[model samples]
Target: MDVGLLFDLRNPAQWHRPWADHYARTLELCEEADQRGAGGLWFTEHHLFEDGYLPQPLTFAAAVAARTRRARIGTSVVLPALHNPVDLAEQAALVDLVSGGRLELGLGAGYRLPEYQLFGADFQRRFAGTERNIREILRLWEEKAVTPLPIQDPPPVWGGFYGPRGARIAGRLGIGLLHISHAMFGHYREGLAEGGHDPRSARVSDLLPIILAEDPEAAWHRVAPHLAHQVNSYRQGSVEGTGRSTPLLTAEDLRDPNAQDTRGLLDILTPEDAAVRIRELTKDLPVRHLIFWASIAGMPDDLVTENIRLVTEKLPPLLR
Candidate 1:
């Protein structure tokens, strides 16, 4: 499995650091991860959050491309519901050229309604809109009029899927599939076959939240607040919209330091244990890449750096 790092670039109000520090620190971390042999650096997209979640991931990805020669720079999921596909294609092509063709674009119809509202995108037509956007992007890449052609011929594009329908669209479009959970791998593969494509040739990837430490207990305590905040942020944002299933630990449960049942919420493991879990994944899922989100809910720079280091150094050897 190709291991990568995901950065949300959230400036949580409670973190108590200078707002600009996160961006600078992310650049430094990305460069180091590249030098240390990380396969990719993925950035997340969100808009109008209180603590300034990254809205322009492609822009940040451009900076990452300039600083890192090896790591594939990408957006975990760029919301096409809020963008002009032609403009997005232009920007992505530029980043691809800068990164020497190392770009993996993950497009999605985002779940949050407020973001759609803020960007003047129609929530009801998001899936259709995303499909149209992808079509236009692919068309633009092939047409000769498009300038600054991407070094990657038809640069790798992955469609983010929340369910089977999304997976079907990805397969029909002949793009990669980006899933969040291992449980959805079957759905994605089925979609690929449904689209009259060979399931084995279609690329599949996932976003996994993980934390590593010498002591699992200490790591769990350290990441619990951030994990809770990350989960709660989505829950709170979905109040007026369609909400997903509730986890064992609600935002309130995690807020209480004494809460005991936060076990399955995230993977809190020592480096050795983390490697074992990752190895087990290859047996069941058709995952070409595994992207880990180490910097969660404004985790401290030092802790985030160490987690990245541990995963980058330890996980690959075990997989091999």
Candidate 2:
């Protein structure tokens, strides 16, 4: 499995830093990971976020391309229905060129209603819209719609469909799925067959948010608050037309053990244990790349750097 890192580039109000400092620190970390032989550096997208969640991942990805010589720069999921497909094609081609052809584009129909509404996208037809966007993107690359074309003829496109029906749609599109769970596994294979593509052609990847640290308890203490903030931020949706930015939860809120939002995703493991859990997660699937959060909601620079080191060095050996 190719191990990678995922970043949302969120700088929350409580832990805010100058935007330039935040970006610089994150890029430096990416360079460190790349030098250590990380398989990829992936970014996530969201618009109008209160914590200033990354609005344009492709833009950030272009920066990563310039800083890293090895890691594959990609977006975990870009909501293409919100923009013109040709524009996306050009932007992706530019990044691919800058990165020397290391770009994996993952497209998804985002769930937040306001994002779709704000972009004037047809929310109801989002599922179909995503597929159409994928088709147009592929066609544009295939037809050389841009000058000189992308370095890779049709860089791999992935569908970030975490639902049963959507999994089949990804399969029918003959692309990859950002699937880390088994819930939609069978459906994707069936869809691939239905699309007259071999089921073996199905590629899978995902982001599992956990930390690998020497002292699990201490690491958990530091990351729990950030993790809670990350999860609870998604829950406190706005009634008005603005994006979610309020009612941020502290680590204390998540300590209840019954704090509905935790969903048991918080864990800080010894690298040894993480290797076993990861093995179990992928044993039954054809997992091409396995991703983990680089840092959860910007925990701490020193700690985040260490986690990246452990992941790129210690963790890979254990897996081997």
Candidate 3:
């Protein structure tokens, strides 16, 4: 149960701050998370969103690296089809250097149609393209002529997938899996085994949204609107594989906290509630990292700070 804070850096219109202010506050949160003993700080990537969802995660990651000393910095999943793999490799290497080798790379075949259209990339071929990109990036890293190599021997590689093919590709490449649902754990590990890798050695990290308050209901109320914005925006963008929106969540559900099934997608909990959930989730899976969204769509800075404080004070010991 290595715990971390996930930064999306969204600036929603309803509660928009100036772009500069938003970025400054985001940096503040990262420094705070690092100082408070967070194990890692993960970032999400999106492009051309009304909310200004983070488009250049690695760039921001570099800034975060410069500001924080302890926590590992990573992209939850950087889209490979959007950029030339060779260039991405160089950018990633620089960030790793800036972070003192504390970078974890999670590459994925993205699922948004508009993004693909804007980049003139074939949506249908993104998975194959992503695989090729990963191989090319690694190959570049190994070439003797490549200069300013990453500080880590090679920062650990992770693959983001919504299905088995992605899992198989990652396993075959000896990369870790970034899975969102418990249902995919077995498929991921099995893929690793099939790829001639030991399942026990393959890392699996789950990403989710989290909010904390002593009164769970109160927390839900405070977080609902922002959470809805987070989910609905992604829903509109449309996920590439297996569909983007959670089948269990509807537009109405996003607006009504009670209507959403908080179990799988959202982790709005009290410390006691998180203890139970973490225990159940880790009981059977090799869940190494539990990364969550801390600063999100218009979530008040005070509330975000309080959630970080509460989780830091209470959650880690239970995992031990």
Best by lDDT: 2
Error of 1 at 315 (Å): 1.3
* Candidate 1 residue spans exceeding 4 A from truth: 180-183, 240-264
Query: What are the lDDT figures for the candidates, one per model?
Result: 0.81, 0.86, 0.80
User: Can you list the residue pairs that collide in candidate 2?
Assistant: none
Model 2 Cα shift for residue 294 (angstroms) = 0.9
Between candidates 2 and 3, name the one with more favorable TM-score: 2
Clashing pairs in model 3?
A: 111-240
Candidate 1 collision pairs = none
Q: Work out the TM-score per prediction.
A: 0.90, 0.93, 0.90
Model 3 residue 211 distance off true place after TM-score fit, in angstroms: 1.9
lDDT-superior candidate, 1 or 3: 1
Lowest summed lDDT across 10 adjacent residues in model 3 is found at 240-249
lDDT by residue for model 1 over 170-206, one digit each (tens)?
8778888887456666677777787787887767787
lDDT of 2 by residue, 41-160 (tens): 999888878889999999999999999998888889899889899999999998899999999998998877788888899878998898898889989888887675788888888889
RMSD of 2: 2.3
